[model samples]
Target: MSKIQAKDVNGVRVLILNRPEKRNAIDLEMYTQLTEYLIQGNSDNDIRAFMIQGQADCFTAGNDLTDFLKHTDIDPQHPAFRFLFTLLDITKPIVAAVAGAAVGIGTTLLLHCDLVYADKSAKFQLPFVHLALVPEAASSLLLAQTVGPKKAAELLLLGDSFDAETANKLNLINDILPSDSLFDFALDQATKLASLPPQALQASRRLMRGNIDGIRLQMHAELEEFSTRLKSDEAKTRFHAFLNKKSHKPT
Candidate 1:
């Protein structure tokens, strides 16, 4: 079975991350599939909105680093980069149902979403600082814009995980629901979005995404720079230490 499952619910196209055992950590194959799905979904008139969720107790543990180190090319045109760019450009409203660990890209991706419904256990982080790398997904810019520079610096530079309540206080989430009911709540919201005026909805979404072509170009450049730094001695040291500490932590 594919790591990313695409399904159409009413007019909401749902993308569910499938690697429960791995906390839905994204690898190259999953990223490629996600890119294809997003591209196809945009051209599907029947789809009015997009919804993303995860299986089990986690949204994602972030990228599968070892698989990434092995298969990821240094180019900015990687599948992961393509997928992130596609997501940022999508005009349709995106709603995310986040539960459990939303680490790294898991959390940054939500910054692009129009609405987010998080489970009480949800935790978010941008660990690039600790890894001696910079942010991907244009999050360095988007996040600071969303929550202001000081908060963004605290999250990005410190790379510490914060809980759902703190996230809600910062207006990062629409609501925090029990894990069991998160999907239902998000689907309820998506159904409402599906019923709204399409042209108006698209227009509003576009406004929020402002200057996307330009932002997408910037993100590509940012990812290229980040990819180069990912192989640096400092990055390798920090990354390996992270992996070692992570490996010993009982999940």
Candidate 2:
């Protein structure tokens, strides 16, 4: 089953994260479906614009860790890595609607999106340090490129979380709206994008970020080192502690 659901709002295609029960954590299957659509959406003439959002309160709780053990790899050959390529390569206007917790990849992924609307209650983080992994999805470069090295280091190295308001002030997110209105507002904005001169919109986007290209191999190299760290005694201890902490938390 696909963790992503698809629908067309006029000529704009909407892709929503469907695993709300798990707080929209990305499993391997979701990655495949998401990447497939990102690649497919751009090439399809019917799709004039695209939007991505979560199913419920949370944007994504990041990758599903237990599920990631067998399939996760930083190698560009890995399908997961290919998924990042699709996201970064999408030339069309991409919008994001973030609710509740936007963890790890959830936060990094927004760096590539064109316009981001977050719920006032939204929380964001890139907690790779806590997991003993380096940021993947070429986020190490992208985050620093967008937010400057000091701020990026503060988030990625410290594994800290931030609120949507703070994210907007920092220009990390475009706007923070009420949770109830987020998806509708994003769709409305998407409709506006769909009504624009498609070629000019695409051309403008390309012009701004055209110089940034080819981070797949770099991500692969970084993750090889990251996976090695994941297997280390230090990371093993931290991972177990996190699991233990979660186990004791109230559900």
Candidate 3:
């Protein structure tokens, strides 16, 4: 079965993260799938908008550490980078339904979405500092722009998890819905967007987002730093410690 499941509702392309056992942790393969789906949806005229979701209990646990540990050296062609860049380039409106954990890239990816709806079960964290790495997805630039430098510093520097309510206050989410209804609510919103006049809808979206050249530049800078950090001794130690902790978990 595909880790990233694709479905269509009306004109909306819905992508679901399907690795429930891993709490929907994104691996390289999943990243590639996500990129392909977004690229496909963006180019297909029939697909008016895109919706990203996961199981009601989990949006995503973030990247799979096992994959990260094995593939530390990265470039623009890397699956993770390709996925991030795809999110930036896609012109169609993207709506996200986030239920449980949105960690690392999980949280960063939402910054690019046109709309984000979450549930009380949602938990968000940057954790790049904790992992001895730098932020990617242009989060270092966008987070501060979204929530101010002080708050962004707290989120990125401290590397702690915040609840859905807190995320709402930070303007990270449109609203919090009951977990049972979050998916339907997000889908409804995506369908509404899909129903709108396509050219106008896309044009309005592009205008609202303003220039993305800066975002693209920031992503390239982040990629360079992320690649350097991934090869660092500190990052290696942190990754090892993290994996060791997980392996010793009482399972």
Per TM-score, the best of the predicted structures is 3
Deviation (Å) of 179 in candidate 3 = 1.3
After TM-score superposition, the amount by which residue 174's alpha carbon in candidate 3 deviates from its true location, in angstroms, is 0.3
Candidate number of the best lDDT:
3
lDDT head-to-head 1 vs 3, winner = 3
| Candidate 3 wrongly placed segments (more than 4 Å) | none
What candidate 2 gets wrong by more than 4 Å, as runs, is 214-218
lDDT of 3 by residue, 82-121 (tens): 9999999999999999988999989999999999999999
Q: After the best TM-score superposition of candidate 3, give how far the Cα of residue 111 lies from its true spot, in angstroms.
A: 0.2
Better of 1 and 2 by TM-score: 1
Query: Candidate 1's residue-wise lDDT over 1-251, tens digit each?
Result: 87899999989999999998888999889998887887888888888999999974899999888776675366656777878878887878899999889999998899889999998889898898787888988888888888889999999999999999999988888899987889988988997998899899999888867778777777877788787888788878877887899899986
Show the lowest summed lDDT stretch of 10 residues, model 1: 68-77
- In order of listing, the candidates' clash counts read 0, 0, 0
Q: Which ten residues in a row have the lowest lDDT in candidate 2?
A: 68-77
Candidate 2 residue-wise lDDT at 2 = 61
For residues 15-125, could you state the per-residue lDDT of candidate 2 as single tens digits? Answer: 999998788988878888888888788998778889999965789998877665655444655566667767777878889999988998798788878899998889999
Better of 2 and 3 by TM-score: 3
